[model samples]
Target: MDTHIYTADDLDAAAKDIVEGKLVSFPTETVYGLGADATNEDAVKKVYAAKGRPSDNPLIVHVDSEEMVEEYAMPLSDEAKSLIKTFWPGPLTIIFNLKDNVLSKTVTGGLDTAAFRNPNNDLTLSLIKKAGVPIVGPSANTSGKPSPTIAMHVYHDLKGKIAGILDDGECQFGVESTVLDMSTDQPAILRPGAISAEQIQEVIHKPVLDERVHVADAQVPKAPGMKYKHYAPSAQVYIVDSPKDFEEAAKWAAEQDDKVGVMATDAVLNNLHFSNNVESFSLGSDVLSASHSLFAGLRHFDNESDVKSILAQGFSNDGIGEAYMNRLNKSAGQKHFNK
Candidate 1:
């Protein structure tokens, strides 16, 4: 398959293809999304096949406006409404009860809830409007791999597998949206992104943290993406909290007699010592900056064959740190080295 770059004018054509059950890769403020018509089961399945994503992992539906969101999701609570007023057209995803007959079972992974977001980017919003359909869009990459933040990242992972890509440049957030579960009595964060829990609590007047891990029954799930090991790299990843612990762990990792790589902020990099064969890359100091560089850095390390293991520094569990930690944790998987 040939990957075509779409300009603003090509958005209509892209939307047309999406309506016909074709997968169209487009940009969002957070990352590029591989979009399919959410109401079309076949179209949503195409997304799963194109990116090699598991059917059990759920997709987030993108709407052009709040009214569009209301059509698919149940009436929003005052808290959900407040959040939308402040953060819609941005990197915020709200999980709510699905309206009857709105989304296909494939879109919600046969669950009663759905994840929805109204993206701020012009190209994506226009495509949503033109398509005139709620789009089930996940990050445009193979499941369990790094999420694509730029159009090329999409091409790199999906070039031969998908149809076309809309290259609007690098994503602003460089990660997925902050996902809040508003369907329940207590609002909880399903996924963290640019919007922090503190910011959401400030508006809702309730405490919120990361949602507890729930084992989804294979038959049904609130969202499919929640059930899988995601954002993994080829090399094993380990996370340590403080600079001292990271140094010690790096020493230990080096002593393993394997070529290791270190992923941390510039400050942490200055404090660690590794074998001359080991390479170090900075994910920036703050969580937001780290989130931006996380996937690209992993991809860089993954491409280098000599780098056998990756040691990462733990991020603060605040603001964007919540999202950063989620991705980091998933990437590290069983390789996490807590101290």
Candidate 2:
């Protein structure tokens, strides 16, 4: 199946297809998203079917403007307004009370609150505006898989499964957006992304919730992408603390005759010594840089013919690093060393 790379001019036509209940994959600043008309139950259902996403997981409504988000979500608090003013057209998602006239339960997953964002990409923003309704979108990959950063990743995972893909090169953030629930008096972060929780708190002048809480399936989810095991790679991945531990593990992997892939920070990449079959990739100098390349790096090694096992370097659990570490831990699945 051919994945069409749409230019800005084609956004209107693509938006038309989405408005007609077809699935369209478009770029957000963080990652490419599989989008459908948020107000149409049938259209929103197509997103779940196409991505094999769990129906109960809910979806984030992508709007072109902050004003557009207000139409669907009623009574946005002053905190929500402040955050939107500072972070809209960027990688931040806010959860607010659902307006009475909002039509689709599928978009909210039967919840009273919904996640909404104004993405930073021009094509996506224009498409949402052209569609004349919010677009329900999540990362353009099957559930539990690493989020797609490039058009090919989407085509690789979702090719025959979805109707159309709007290739916009690689995603800038290569991760999901920071999700904050503003329905309550104090802002709460349901998920972390490129935007940090501390940053949101600074803007809103209140503490934000960063931990996960159990919710009933019958209720609407406060945030999308919160309930699932996400950002996983195909092969088993192990995240280690430092270069010394990674080197020790490499030796162990070599002795066991298992092909290993090492994802390291730039500081450690050049120092690691491994066999010809042991592949290595660098995550750059800082945590933010690593966050931007984490998924793509995982995809790179996941596709390598010689890779059987993966050893990933752990990052500090601060700022955007928190989100990067969360994805790494999820990808690792098991402990660093199997006993």
Candidate 3:
């Protein structure tokens, strides 16, 4: 199948394609999303096939505005309204009770709740508004792979499998949106994203629950990136949780006969012992930059012909570091040495 790349100038055509039940990959502030009309069952199914994503893993719906929620979602609670007021049109997703037969069955995975986000990207919002329906979108990449943060990353994973791609360059946030479940009395964070739990608590003045943040062995994922072994590269990944462990792991990888790669902060990279068999990448100094470059760095190492395996230095799970550590843990698939 032929997949065309669209731009901001071609919003009308892209919107038309989506309304016609065709899949389209577009950029959001968080990551590129493989989008389909959320109300159309056939279109939503195409998204699953394109990403090779499991039908059981629910998709998030992107709407143009908060007012659009009345059409696609069930009545919101007071707490849910507060959250939407605080974080809509940003890197935040909220799971609300699904209205009866309003959305495609494939979108909610037959559950009574659906994830919704009012993205900050102008092009994406314009396309959704033009399509006149909420678009259910997951990250534009093959499932269990690193989520695409750029247009080319989308093309690399889903070129011929989809309809078209809107190239808005690299995404602002290198990770997926923070997903919150507001169905229960106490809100729980299902997925960590650019927006930290602390930040969410600050907005609502209520303690936000983040079980997945502390519990590594949580079996069932309430949201994407939780229960699955996801965001992995082609090569094997191992996480070193401390500077001591990182140094030891790097040295150990260098001694191995197979080619190895190291993903670390500048300080960690500076401390590494370089050799012909090892390639090291600086994933940025601070947590935010680390979050922004994490996927790209993973993809970089995966594409390097000489790199056979990867050793990544883990970050502290504080503030945005929570999101960073979450992705690294999944990318490493819990192959970690904690010190």
Clashing pairs in 2: 111-220
Candidate lDDT values, in order: 0.82, 0.80, 0.83
Assess every candidate by TM-score. 0.92, 0.93, 0.94
Candidate 1 lDDT score relative to the true structure: 0.82
Q: For model 3, how does the per-residue alpha-carbon lDDT over 1-339 read when each residue is reduced to its tens digit?
A: 788899999999899999999999989998899999988898899988988887767889999988898776778777678878888789999988877888766787667888899999999999998999999889999998888888888888988898899999999989888998887778888888877787788877899987564324523334666555789998888887777787668668767899888888888888767677888888888778888989988888865456778888777888788888888888887788543
| Model 1 C-alpha lDDT per residue in residues 265-319, reported as the tens digit of each score | 8888876666776788898876678889888888778754567788887877776
Q: Give the per-residue lDDT of model 2 (tens digit) for 1-339.
A: 444656676776687788788888998889889988887898888889888888878788899887888787786777778888999899998888887857577787777888888999987888887889888889898878888898888878887767678767778888889888787776777777888887887897877876555456565456765566677777788888766686687676677566778888877877767776677888898788889999998888765445777888887788888888877887786357632
Model 3 / residue 13 / CA error / Å: 1.5
The residue pairs that clash in candidate 1, if any, are 56-224, 57-224, 57-225, 58-224, 58-225
| CA lDDT for candidate 3 | 0.83
**Where does candidate 3 stray beyond 4 Å?**
213-222
